[model samples]
Target: MQTKSAARNIFFGGTIFFFVIFVGLVAHSYSYIVTTSTNVKTLTEAVAHGKKIWEENACIDCHTILGEGAYYAPELGNVCKRLGGKDAVMGMIEARQENEEDTRQMPNFNIKGKDLEDLAEFLCWTSTIKTQNWPPNEAG
Candidate 1:
């Protein structure tokens, strides 16, 4: 019931409308990620160094952090809260002992000194991220 020119106008109008909606959604997502999903104030040198160490050692291969890695080990997203504090995390990492009775064991990566401290700091920082109650339990 519409002329060729009217049909063309409707098509272009619809395209523009959808494009604007898409742009608005993208902006919203970006703002949420920058402002709501993370705390920029807590990002420190120690946290960066710890993340670097985590990558260098391939910790993701055995453990899941924020529920992205393998499930072989306990989730470490909320490790700082669950384990008590940074000191407890550091202590656990420092004291890795192999037991024959245990079916699975965490191998000692020999992480120590400032590197160990940084790694713990990184995990503690990760605990502060807003995961919207992810892992669904305190154990994570």
Candidate 2:
């Protein structure tokens, strides 16, 4: 019963409506990322150095950060917060132990000195990123 012209009008109207909605969502996401997701003020030389170490060692091969890497290891997005800060993070890295019965263990990366400090700083900075409560639990 509908006229051809009316059907065409409906299709065009729906396309435009959806396009507008898509644009709005994209803009909102950009604004959120620029304003709330990351802290540029805290990105320091140490953090950059830590990130370089992370990449050089291929840490992403075993661990997930911000939910983006392999799931073989625990997510480290909030490790600084969970473990209580930079010193604790370094301690855990330095003191990693392997139980005989455990099938999986974190190998000692031999990270020390300024490298250790920088890596900790990187992790702490990562912890500060707003993930909207990702990993969903304290264990990650």
What clash count goes with each model? 0, 0
Candidate 1 lDDT by residue in tens digits, 37-100: 8988999999999999999998999889999998888898899989989999999877653344
| Model 1 score (lDDT) | 0.89
* lDDT, candidates in the order shown: 0.89, 0.89
TM-score of every candidate relative to the true structure:
0.86, 0.75
Which parts of model 1 have CA positions greater than 4 angstroms off?
Answer: 1-11, 97-103
Model 2, residue 66: distance off in Å is 1.4
What is the Cα-based lDDT of residue 66 in candidate 2? 89
Over 1-140, each residue of candidate 2 has an lDDT whose tens digit, in order, gives: 99999999999999999999999999999999879999888999999999998898888998999888988987889999999999999987776633435457777678899999999999999999988889799877
User: Looking at model 2, which ten-residue stretch has the lowest summed lDDT?
Assistant: 95-104
